[model samples]
Target: MEFREDILGAPYEAAELTLRPDDEGAVCATLVRRLVPGSERAVLYVHGYNDYFFQTNLADHYTALGFSFYALDLRKYGRSLRPHQSPNFVRHLAEYDEEIDEAVRIIRELDGHRQLLLNGHSTGGLIAALWAGRRAGRAVVDGLFLNSPFLSMPAGPAVRTVGGPAVTAIGRMAPTRVLPSSLNPHYTHSLHKDHQGEWDFDLTLKPAEGFPLYAGWLAAIHQGHRRLRSGLGIDVPVLLMASTRSISTTVWNEGLRRADAVLRADDIAAQGPRLGRHVTIVRIEDGIHDLVLSGEAARTRVFAELDHWLAAYLDVPAIEAPLIDAPLIDARPADARPAGESA
Candidate 1:
């Protein structure tokens, strides 16, 4: 794992990690890092589906908080995508373990970081929670931060129940079969500079119309959701943040900029407690699906909530971090299901 200057350029370095080949022939994941001098703690971030490690502002925020930052572009996505591979295809969510384990080893053992925090957004959030749960009591990670984790499907329970087995069976028979995508392009428009948003990332890597959704991939995600719903007993402190509401629309609307355009915040809040006993669920008003990418006022609240939580839970000294404002809802849902209950 030799580090080289990343596509993001100076001060941000990237390393290519070779993993055991899968049905796709060869596989790899990229680890991008920006180290803060003499920082004892580090953060490992995983981006959502159709996304990569391009949030330099996020890295800047962590570095400002005195922690080194790293991001992973998982196999078949972003920097790790290869010419011969199907975009973002995986038979099982557990397949991610290989790269995640390697990244953790490099961060903790090779880099000599004393404390580690795992941060994930959207689908990455679900992956992080499941990974943390599987490694519960291992102490490999000190804290978990989820930004609008896709814990449950956006559809009603009936649709999930009826479609789950069908998708799995179809996935088994034709793993690469493409499924019709309902991914809202407005979300992409809401984030990219060419549209209504302010960020400038590689559109080819995270296209306005995302990569095809595969049956096998959806099946794997369903399996992961089931496992999470059944409970993995993650024992570490977990900070789960999501938008206060989700806006689902076919046409472009200004509201898309202020609310989550992907996963539902209600679903995320409902499943927050299932993560662990020490979970802290925060709802940021006017926050987008990726809380960090929200508008200025909302992003400020998101970071403030994170800072307050970290100060209380991770032993990070609070630099006069103010109490959470009223716009931020910092409570578990009243009807939160038990750890082992079916969602």
Candidate 2:
């Protein structure tokens, strides 16, 4: 269906873009800050599994820091949806290189920004890390920021070791096939309609579907884990943000609101160093699955840390932290896009 106020349940009208692969067909996509001019630096944000970019105020977060912000609703999600494609599906996560490269190409070329900050959440975090480990990332961006990113698999030791390998191998032979029960309901209330969060995205695109778990996707994630755990030779710096704790996706409780109820924060805190030379790890106590989208008090902490860290490292002066207080861009609850920018 079309990405309308009623259809996508967004806080703003999403602008559509097509990322055509040099080697394959064009993929559907979306860019958040196309109309505004930008600075030498820009952030290209990628969303996690069963997700898309909907929060415009998130764009303002960077813009307020004097950097232009650009977020992509990657293929098969948000405004990029296709009738035939799954919400989020792939045999290998590396296959996303096309979308990543093209998205950067669009931002860098169109906005002509010199520095590209690749920001992501959840699975998108893993994708960003893997991409930054590549040669392109060496020359493309200045840094990376991952929010509640999924690094190592969250399964138990036995499943992670034996079960993962066996299941992944079976997946390659049957890429399009679905694994049973990909969705976990325990965390659903955290993002439901009555939730306290600031976004109002469509559940269909974001899938409340469990996201199909085919063999290729599992193998791709495992490959990323191997590469990251083995140590990536990236030259740029990386910032990883996670909740102070973790809760299982299967266990429903208030703890899910206060901690990352998906991936293990300790694993990320531990493995982040292997991703590159310059790595900074920040843990948000009582943060939710997506730190930025956590409760009010939690968000305050999230922005404080972000502001302090960005100033100390990027040399950016302290500006107002990101909040949902700017002008309304659409019909959803509350969202804003930061004011003017460079280029």
Which 10-residue window in model 1 sums to the lowest lDDT? 327-336
Reference-based lDDT, residue 338, model 2: 38
| lDDT for each residue of candidate 1 in 1-343, tens digit (9 for 90 to 100) | 7999999999999999999999979999999999988888999999999999898888988999999999999999999999999998999989998999999999999998999999999999999999999899899999999999989988878999999999999999999999999899999999998999999999999998999999999999999999988886998999999887889999999999999889878889888888888888888889999899999999989898888888898988886768655643644543565666532
Off by over 4 Å in 1: 327-343
| Number of residue pairs clashing in candidate 1, backbone atoms closer than 3 angstroms, sequence gap of 3 or more or interchain | 0
Clash list (residue pairs), candidate 1: none
So what's the TM-score on candidate 1?
0.95
Taking the tens digit of each residue's C-alpha lDDT, what string does model 2 give over 1-343?
A: 1223423333333455555542224566665552235467778888987777765556667776777766777776676767666556665677677778766776687558877778889889988888878853448777788888888787665777887677667777776666665456656567665553445766666656466666666777787787778887767767878876778756557777788777777766777778888877877767877788787777777777777767766676876545433321121111122344211
Number of the predicted model whose lDDT against the real structure is largest: 1
lDDT values, one for every candidate: 0.91, 0.69
Per-candidate total of colliding backbone pairs: 0, 9
